[model samples]
Target: MRIVHLADLHLGFRAYHRLTDRGINRREADVFAAFREALDRTAALQPDAVLVAGDVFHVPRPSNYALVQSQAELLRFRQKCAAPVVMIAGNHESVRSADNRCILELLTAVPGVQVVTENPEAVTLANGQVRVVGLPHNSLSRLNTIDLRPDPQVPYNVLMLHGTVDSSRINDYGGYDVPADLLELPWDYVACGHYHTYTHLGRHAYYAGAIERTSNNIWQEATEAKGFVLFDLVSHQAHFQTLHKPRPTLDLPTVDAFGKDVAALNQELAANVAAADITDKLVRQKILNLPKSQQARLDARQIRQWQTQAVHYLLDARPPTATLSEAIAPDIAASQGLTATVAEYLRQRELPKDLDRLHFVERGLAYLAQTEES
Candidate 1:
């Protein structure tokens, strides 16, 4: 039987400040468009079943527009494909309080769709030929307390879960974790979510990855193809299909500004920006080893003009270290801005081999930027 595996849709995810012609957030519109494309392709493939592991929405409390648009798309999928679509809730759609309802529960009203908001539930599909055991995102207490083993009654079982398997690689964004031993469970296939990059854990287990760029690490994930997997249960094999072309992102090489006058620094920055095609792409330019005096003298108006030409531009500037005499005093070192210090500290730490340190630091810096703005 052919089964399509997809996860981390993040339908309502928003970024930058650009707005579409319809007055909706540009990023939100991009995400919604990507989902529509995926659904369109799924209908064409005519799979027996479509499995959506988790993170259906960016947040548990999505806007009414997001809800209405998603419902329309899902109903269209049901009408066009006539196939069962099984979905589970991820951390983004999980609610902490019992009184608070998970927005995913709204999807239960849609025909040909099954929404699993709680863990340890099994749903049979294809006239009992396939048994899918779902484990949705849950609190740590619930994760530890639940029974995660596969059902012995079914030989063709698929384990669907949204959590971290390798504890060593935990994301700052919250997610429940299961021991790596869980991957060893007796199942025909294991579909995982919560990680935004496609990965093959074993012959059968896989992460389909997000449909579009949904995080600050867009530059890093840009290198990886963004798409879904078509898993053939009969043959125990999977094939990835790219859903959409990702938005272009350019991370320019760092420029050292030591000893360069304001005119020289401006010339270098202007030349680098001119060399790259940043017209409609997300771009980042960093100037390092600059002194405070040089930064003050830099032409702010020209930088603003450069930013206007691109869809989104980030200009990061780092100041040079103090002189030996100034370094002798602890106060001078501590005087650096909190955001700058945080970046420096993260740069010094030894991160895990699998983790991209540049992305990690970039995310941290993004958060810091948001905090400062708020």
Candidate 2:
């Protein structure tokens, strides 16, 4: 039996403040496009079953557009393929409250689509030809307590779940750590999600990875191939299928700004930016060991203009440790007013470029003021 394993669609994930021609968030549109392409390819593959291990959405409560787009795609898949599509909730779409239903449960309305949201459950499909045990995302307390075992009676037993494996190279993203012993279970294959990078734990277990880049670790993830896995039950072999070409992302080499004046630093930066091809790419420039005084002297307007050269440009300037500590000491020592303190804190915080720092600081200060008054 042929089975396609895919995960971490992360539909509606938005970033970089870029808007499409239709005014939708560009990253969101890109994510949706990637999923759509995957579905199209899956339809052509015509596998006996499709396994979506977890993280169908970027958040539990997605935008109406995202919901509609996802529903439509699943319906399209249902119409095209005769195989059953089994899905489970990952941390992103898992709810903490029992009162709230997981968004994944809504997909059950689509024919041939089965969803597991609350707990671990075993589902048999294709007239007992395949038996899949699904463990959906739940609280860490529940994950640790749940029992997982393979059915010895089934000829093809697949274990599907979403979580990090102990000592895996992928980041956990605050999800439960699935013990490596679970992968060692006597199952034919184990399909996993939650880690955005594709990984093979052994001959039997695999993480399909996100179809599109979805985190700040894009620089690192870029080095790894991103896509889904096609597992043949009869042969016990898996093939990775690359679905989309990721948007170009460049992490420029770090610059040692020690002992350089602002003019010299700016010149160096300008030369690097010009020499490196950043056109229509997301780029990060790191200026290391620069003093606050020197950083202050740099032309902010000129640096800001670099954003125009690339699709998105981030200038990450690391002030000398002594300079940073000295800058923070006065604020804590003097106990600067709430607004000033909040502004300082926001300035030091690492935020996505899509967010407006000035606006965020204003809102934070306003909230703090209201709390003080109350």
Candidate 3:
């Protein structure tokens, strides 16, 4: 069986406040473009099945544009391909309210598509030649209650879910630490999501990753490959398929501004900008250890002009050591840090009584450090 494993489409996600002539957010448009491209290319391949691990939408309630585009594109996909598609509700779309239905459930109206919202289900497809076990984000919480064994009769047993697993490199975190045993299952293929970077967990397990960069952490994922995984069950090979013209989010090399004055800083910043193809890209340049005094004198007019060059530009001029706190603005930034602020926010927000907030934040923070700059 040939399958296209895709995840974290994150439709309706917006960032950097960029907009197109049509007034659609540029990042949102980029995500939509990726979905269209992935579907179009998947059709060309004519895979037997498509596995969308999770996070199909950035949030539970997507915008009208997202809903309309999703319906239209999904219908378009059905028209071009006959493969069965299985999707689940990712954390982004998983709500605490039991009264509210998952957004993914609406996609079930489309023929040849299966949506798993709150629980785990095993769907046998392709004339019973394959078994797809779908564990949505909420279902992950009840892992012990569910059956993890694969169907012995099925030729191919595939596990599709959203969340993170405990790995050697689990420190740079994002999601709850799924027991490593989850990946130890004997499924022919295990498809995952949540983390934006495409990851290979085991011989048959993989995170197809977001088709395009989706969150504030796009800079960290700048170097990692983004695309869906095309797994050939027969050959036991998972091929990474690249998307065409994914919007560039580049993290340019940092320029040391330790002792440089405003004049020297301008020259340094100008050189870095000129060296890269930042046009229409989301770019960031950090001049580490810049004096607090020099920061105020930066030529705003020149910087504003540079900002216009990229879709969005950020010049992080970190202040030098002189304070009681070594941390630089740690709240949501690296100086004070992303973890504490996010943890504090979580404490303020409502959570399930059974949920362990401390553990939840720590595990995700492990992978996030690598993916996000905080």
Relative to the true structure, how large is the alpha-carbon lDDT of every model? 0.81, 0.82, 0.81
lDDT tens string, model 1, 197-267? 88888768998888888864776664677889998988998999897645667877667775567899888
lDDT of 3 by residue, 44-120 (tens): 99999999988899888999899889988999999999998999888888888879988887888889889888888
Residue-by-residue lDDT tens digits, candidate 2, 1-374: 98999998888798888788999987888888888889888999999899998889999999999999899999997888888999999999899986999998888888999998887888898889899998887843476677778778888999998888755556547578787888898889999988888888887999888988886577776456677999999899999998765666788876767656778888888888888888877788878767666778888888777887777888888865534343344746477765676567567654457999888878888898899899
- Among all candidates shown, the one with the greatest TM-score: 3
Q: In candidate 3, which residue ranges exceed 4 Å CA deviation?
A: 167-174, 322-374
Per-residue error for 53 in candidate 2, Å, reads 1.5
Select the stronger candidate by lDDT from 1 and 2: 2
Model 2, residue 167: distance off in Å is 3.9
Better of 1 and 3 by TM-score: 3
lDDT of 1 at 162: 91
